[model samples]
Target: MIVLPRAMMPIIVACWLYYLLGVVVVGQYEWQTRDAFDEIRMRMDKVNDDNCQIQHLGDLYLPEDAVSHLPDIKDININPVFPNRTALLHLHNMALSRSFFWSYILQSRFIRPAINDTYDPGMMYYFLSTVADVSSNPYINASAIYFSSNMSYSPSYRGFFNKTFPRFAPRTFRADDFNDPIHLERISTRNTFTVQDLGAFPTTRLSDDYTTDFYRINEWYKKWLPDNVDKRHDTKTTYQIEIRYANNTNETFTFHGPPGADEYPGPVKWTRPYFDCGRSNRWIVAAVSPVADIYPRHTGFRHIEYPTYTAVSVMEMDFDRIDINQCPKGKGNSGPNRFANSARCKTDTTEVYI
Candidate 1:
């Protein structure tokens, strides 16, 4: 090897340092992204459910084609309804109540990271709003309790590499700050909308008001964004609708693309149940997050996208239907194979995790 000049040695060393910086920066970014998902699910799991209302619905299951099978499933224009003010407050606060790492922001030329645990209201809103916007299922938020768990993961010690990062998020996402997710608990009385003989379909975050009811929502969203955050705007969203049926089975559906014009016939997504003035069914609607390009593929963590989302949207809805069946404690989700103790069937609860 040729001997390098003394002056060149400093440049070589500088190059080496730059290389190490990328390794550390990239590694930190990847882990922070991975960990965000991990904490959310962990929080959701730790919380005790108030009780799944769906359990009461007799052991009914929606077939895969439940939506497509409907007599008029194709003729619907699914004008989504949104949550009420009380519910909105709860959702908005839960999202802004805590601090978190804005990993997506890391990629943004805009935001500059701060210290661990530094609160950034905007990122929280992004996380909360993204899930809510896609669909209004509470489980999506519930399972992501980690998003707000005010904990930090970046190593305390740093070399020159540390400088490469703007600043570690001051606060890690925490659930305690907000009530975790509103849906995980029983529907609040204020939000309850009963259907005569059937159970209730309390207003979820996905209610149309989220979009139309933009004023109050903005009060929270309008908060000072993390530095360099872009102004908020809407994007075309694709939501995968999941329903927990009466037979203790799951029915899944999604929008391959926008619905057709006119008759809106053929290959439509999500069953559009006619809302008779009386006597209707109850179900849970959980939302999954739209895909975020900032994250990597096969993120070991679950619930990153729909089975595979094309773009990031505001919310992800997962519905849990609770008809009046409380299937006799004998029916098994997989048949007699189901047990009361197993809490698994006529309870065949499957989730399309976001």
Candidate 2:
């Protein structure tokens, strides 16, 4: 049996009591923390389950037993961040308007004859100038605006002359037969002509000026190209001539056949995006339409004649210029837009709706 002093005994008891109180408090705190964490986990699981249910409902079919059903929800919530709609609208309108212009030219009496190689240079110049004056839309500063017509002649006629009466050939000086038998014989003897037999001959003639700049394009090409070195092609004189406004001036340009040249037989054709290294020196797209007769001719028989194509007109525009100021300024993909701003709305140029 050991006895302690009264003062020491009290101090030792006090120390033991302090230790017990600390253990109880710390255990209580730890238990509370664990309980709070479990509660948070349970809430998160409920939220996940609710989200799954909502997604599953989206894939379910409507109830057949319902008396009346609401119409489908078609209200699209397009935010202002979208700009593709705006850009697409602009492109579509531009293409549509250009189609109308080319269609009008092909339908005109003078222009159709011009394509067939019957018009005089003076008349062609006048026609080209008139078209250029109205070709530019007031809203866009087009990098280049041009029109091209090709004169394709084969001595064999490729069944074209066979379709017409024999009397129609010698009696009438058709577009293909400009100066009668002499011209026909001359063209038949050779594969190609160094000079243009027609007024708008692409190898030589321009809108108001003529040049030998594109003389290399005069040779026979299996395909249409200005500088086609591979001359081992069939016999066909397909040359394209242009009346153009580019480099702040009126001039004539020529091309054998670029990417979209042959597609004019169908509806208005738009070329894929391309880089114009020779002339425009920028990314561009071309719209081409063929010069075709609008009215059918009476063949004196029961059969009706359909429209025939002569030449193709082309319009080149800057790709960036077409898009203009339609895109949004933010970081994420701008989804769509409802309205497109035209030249009339934002530019000082003339107002023409697409």
Candidate 3:
């Protein structure tokens, strides 16, 4: 073999050394990343046993062949058994595309929203709500499925990704607008009926179980523990829901969720024969903070610096109980979307036209 000149040998050795160093650096960085993930998970797993009771909703898994695509949003498709006000609406649990929501993956798994890609689970909390009534007059169905979107935390990449989707303006809109004309019937600033209905049906369903009148819905399950917000607001709201986790594993932790808006809170009790769950997006993920470590006292805003991921979700849902008038044939006992689970009624209403 011909021997290399001295300078060439140094250069070759330097190149080889550089490659070795890069491998080491990358491995170290990955290890650090994993360590950070462990910290986040440790913090997330801490459940305060003080004020609230733990209700483990369900666990997450790789999408099966049947549910690989998103399904009807209203059907409580994350897991069938856990009940909600309107199925405690657990949407999708997004991670770094390949990791669990809790694994510190999503924050760094930045992706560009391609053309016509509406929801980048990394970018926004797409709170999807459709007009609850599909009557001839779309505006009349002012009611909507309220209280969606868990608190989703995205890493602030140069500050663009950190801000919440402010409102309907030139830049963006609520994802619910995409729910098709049959459901979205022009209930916006344009409609006078929409204004009247928004005022009439202000039943903001909350993520947490709160104190209720305990009349028809007799639920005593306290909110998820390690309470950040003082108000278990749902307890005070007109309707309440409790989700018992389908998982028996003790590794479960209660994630903190953003409260649902009270402005367009739908009617307390209503049926939806008019609205079809099949017409809606099948799987919805309401992202929440994986770790909610601090909250400023005065503002009542939870200060979060945690990554977001969810292991449990509802794959299917059936209303635990609805009026005999709506689920007349005991359809409530059946899984989601059997008959007229669409009818909404008040606890006091004796005469339901539906």
Ranked by TM-score, top first = 2, 1, 3
Please give the TM-score that candidate 2 achieves against the real structure: 0.28
Candidate 3 segments exceeding 4 Å error: 1-157, 160-304, 307-354
Query: How well is each residue in 1-354 modelled by candidate 1, as lDDT tens digits?
Result: 998899899999999999999898888542323332243334334322333222322122222212111122222346322222233233323332211122332223113343442332343453444333223433222212121111212233232221222211111111222333656764442222211100112335322121122212211111211112134312222335565878998855433222223333321122221111111122222111222122222233434422111221111112222111223444222122111132213436677979
Q: What is candidate 2's lDDT per residue for 1-354, written digit by digit as tens?
A: 999988898899999999999898787643333332243234334433224223232121111111011111121133342243333333334443443443334333233323333322232342443244224342221211222222222222322322321111000000222445667554532121121122333333442221122322111110122222233432222234455456765534322222232332323444443443322234444443333332222223323433333334344445444432322323442222211121123334687899
Q: The CA-based lDDT of model 2 is what?
A: 0.32
**Model 1 regions lying over 4 Å from their true place:** 1-61, 68-107, 110-123, 126-282, 285-289, 295-354
Per-residue lDDT of 138-160 in model 3, one digit per residue for the tens? Answer: 21222221111233333332233
Q: Look at candidate 2 and give me any clashing residue pairs.
A: 82-335, 82-336, 138-350
Q: Of the candidates shown, which would achieve the greatest lDDT relative to the real structure?
A: 2
Stretches of candidate 2 off by over 4 Å are 1-135, 138-266, 294-305, 322-354
**Higher-lDDT candidate of 1 and 3:** 1
Preferred candidate (lDDT higher): 1 or 2: 2
Give the whole-model CA lDDT for all candidates, comma-separated: 0.27, 0.32, 0.26
